[model samples]
Structures are given as structure tokens and as C-alpha cells.
Target: MRSTFSAVFTIFVTLSVCAASPFTKRAVTLPPLNGKFDYQIGGPYTPAADVAVVTRDNSASPVSGKYNICYINAFQTQPDAASFWQSSANAGLLLHKSDGSLFEDADWPGEYFLDTRTDSNRQAIATILNGWIDTCHSKGFDAIEPDNLDTFSRSTNLLTAADNLALAKLFTDHAHSLGLAVAQKNTGGELGASGKSTAGFDFAVAEECQQFEECDSYTDVYGNNMLEIEYTDNGISAWNAACKARGSAISVIYRDRDVVPSSSKAYHYQEC
Candidate 1:
């Protein structure tokens, strides 16, 4: 009986270890960096062309058989879901100013910042995000694109790059555990080799790399594993010049800032 109990304990330990270990390296095929890509975070519409990769919000289902990427607002709150967090038992999870008022993302109304200043707050936020990651995996997403990674830059000096990077690592690990590749969303072209290596991102989804003249920063790190999105007319012009110079080896697309579906009058989608 003693031997049998020891054997059972060993088996349990091994199983636990397996469950806890995430795939450190990508075990799935990555979206082609040069393939036509679309940003559909606002809403999903019919694919207009030979799109190779597409990103959509977590609440939406993945496009059938495409290299679908799930978008999660990991570092900041979504504007529409303000009340969801405000009314939660973990309301304190949101960042607060010195006077105790909730900090907001000024440009994005209704969107608040998540507190990543301490281990407890980071872990609490991760706990909430892990559920979304699980849903993304279960729903057959090929990868995850956690938006607002640059939140620390807008954190009003209350947060640091290290704080956001630590939170990013948590999300990256969780996505990998479920066999989902993770993409680094905008770090403002400032993620040096150390930053990229520390976060362990599998790919990158950059916004306005052309307009910002930071395309090299992403391509230098992720190689052909980067997707670019341009929002404005000038940004589109910049994208055209970049694509013409870089050739078909770079995936580029243009969409309205909101990325709304075709039914909306504001809907806009195009590819390079």
C-alpha cells in the first residue's frame, strides 16, 4: 500500500508539472508576415480578398480556416465594458490617481487603465485575462494580439515599462500554455532586443509603422512575422510607399480606426 500511494503521488506531480508548463516555443504555424492581413477588431465582415491573416476581438468567432488572431485588451479596459469592471468586486484592480480617482486613457474615452504597479494587482488582472485567453484558444484562434501594450507610456508616471512588460509576460505565458502564439501589439517601436526577448512574443502587430517610420524596428526583430495597420489617408500614403519599396514580402493593410464591419457607414478596409 505504501508503494502504491507513492506511485500515485509521483504520477500526480508529473501531471501537475505538465499542466503548468506552457510551450515556450511556438508549436503552431505562424501567420505569414507578407500575406494579406486584415484588422477586424471593430466587427467581422466578409473577407474581401485573399487575406492570409486576420485579427478580431475576443467576443467574435474566428474566421473559418484562416490564420485568425484573437485581440484582447490586456493592459487597458475596453470602453464598452467600463461598467463591468466598475461594478466588480475587484474594482480596485483599476489604477487610481493619488486622490483615489480612477485613471483614464485620455484619448480613448470610457477606457480606464488597469493597475500593474504591484504583484497583487498584476496577478489579479492576469486572473481575469486568463479566462479570455482560454476562450480564444477554445474558440480556435491561431494566435493572440493583446492590445494596449504601450499603456505604460500613457500611465501618467504611475506605471513603468517594467510593470507593463511583467504583465505582458503573464499574458504571453498563458497564451502559450494553450498552444496559442502571442503577438506584441504596439510598444511604440521602442522594444529593444532585451524587451522583445523578455516578453517572449512570437510575432508583432504594429499600427502605423509607416507613418511613424518604425517599420524597421519591428521587421528587424520579428522578421517577416509582423503585420502593419494604417488608419489615416497620410498613413495610407506612407504604407503605399513602404510596400512599394519593401515588395510583397511585407503584409500591409488599411482600415478605419474603428475597424467597423461593412454594415457600418464608417467601415473601411483595403490591402496593399
Candidate 2:
């Protein structure tokens, strides 16, 4: 009986060790996406990279590509609030003021935050966003990159870090169950033990990691499970140096801030 107990204990330790392995060894080869990939002002879809993430509303114009990341405003409402996504159903979760005005992120001026504090609200948001993740799965995306994980920080003391992490875990588990890996978009700076264990995340879609001098945090926490997008040559060079020196596995790409279509003179794309 003692021997049997020891064997079971050993097996448990082995499984735990394997599960906790650093993100480096699990790195994947990302195909180039150095083309016009728009996050706003959606129009006709075109295959831009090995993967193209386009807004779901633009599904009318499909990008005939190998992999796609259908963009859903999973965390917040788009400027066109009432057209298709009615705010009435999600009124409780929508950010509001004492006077009932919406909380605004001026850069994305019109979009308002969703109150992700309560379990009920989070689950409600999860249910709706799960539909979007399912749509991406049905549409054949290799992965789902849910933008604005950091938006809770923009929640004006109403949204706690714990609230964001809990909601993120909800979405992450749902995505995986549907057989799609999800990414923690642009949260490279916020990863830690308290990050609620970024365990289930497959990889990261980091923007400007080099420019922020925060690439090392990602390389350490996420290991090679990263794809960096830089908007400047200096950032690209720094990315290469940091990633290469650590023998880390990372795909790096450069793009114009606008990611303007090839028809535009301001269009820019690069891969390294």
C-alpha cells in the first residue's frame, strides 16, 4: 500500500512539472502577416498574411486565407453601438456614470467599457463573446486573439485586476474547449504570478514590446511563445537582438501604424 501511494504521488509531481514548463519550449512557428491588417474602418477583406484577423462584420468580404482571426469587440462596444449589438441586453455590464453617462477612452472616443466586476456580468459577457469565438472557430481561424485584455485598467477604479483576470480565464477556457488557442493581446507588461497564471494561453500577440523595453518580460514569462509587431526600424532591431541573444523562438514583423492597404503610399510591411 505504501509503494502504491508513492507511485501515485510521483506521477502527480511529474504531471505538475510538465504542465508548469516555461512557455519557451512550446513556441510555434508563426507565418508572416506583414500586410494590410486593419483593426478599424473595415472594408473588403483580403488575404494579408499566413493569418489575417479581420472584423467579423466584414465577413461579407472574406479573406481567402489559410488562417484568420475574426476580430470581435469582445471587451468593449464599437462606436456603432445600436446598429447590430444592442446595448439594452448588456445594460448592467455597460460602464456608466453617476449620471448614467458612458466611460470613454478618448483614443477610441466613442467605445465604452463593460462592467466586468460582477460574476453575473462577466458570465453574461462571456456568453455573448463565446458566440464570437465559436464563429471564428467555424470560420477556420488557427487561433483567437482577443484584444483589450488590459482594458480593465481603463475601468476607472470600477474594474479590478481580479475581475479582468477572472473574465479572461472564462474566455480562455471556452476558446480551448472549442479547439482554438487564444492569445493575451498586448498584456506583456502585466504578466506575473498574480496574472492568474497565464497557463492556458498558447502564445502572445505583442505590439511594441521592443520600444517599451519590455520584451524581456515576455521572453521570460511567455518564453518563445510570442510574435512581435513593431512599427519602427529601431524597434525591429531591438526585437531581433533581444530575441536572438536568448535563443528565444519569436516571429517578428514590422508594419505601418495604420496598416494601410497596399494601394496607399503610407503602406509598409516587413518580416524578420
TM values, all candidates: 0.87, 0.72
Clashes of 1: 0
Off by over 4 Å in 1: 1-26, 233-235
Model 1 local distance difference test score: 0.74
Q: What is the C-alpha lDDT of each candidate?
A: 0.74, 0.55
Instruction: Give the top-scoring candidate (lDDT).
Output: 1
- Estimate, for each residue in 58-141, the C-alpha lDDT of model 1 and write its tens digit: 888899868999888888776666666787666988999999988987876777889889987877677677777777887899
Assess candidate 1 and give its TM-score to the true structure: 0.87
Instruction: Give the runs in model 2 whose Cα sits over 4 Å from its true position.
Output: 1-65, 82-86, 193-199, 232-248
Question: Which one wins on TM-score?
Answer: 1
> Model 1: which residue pairs collide?
none
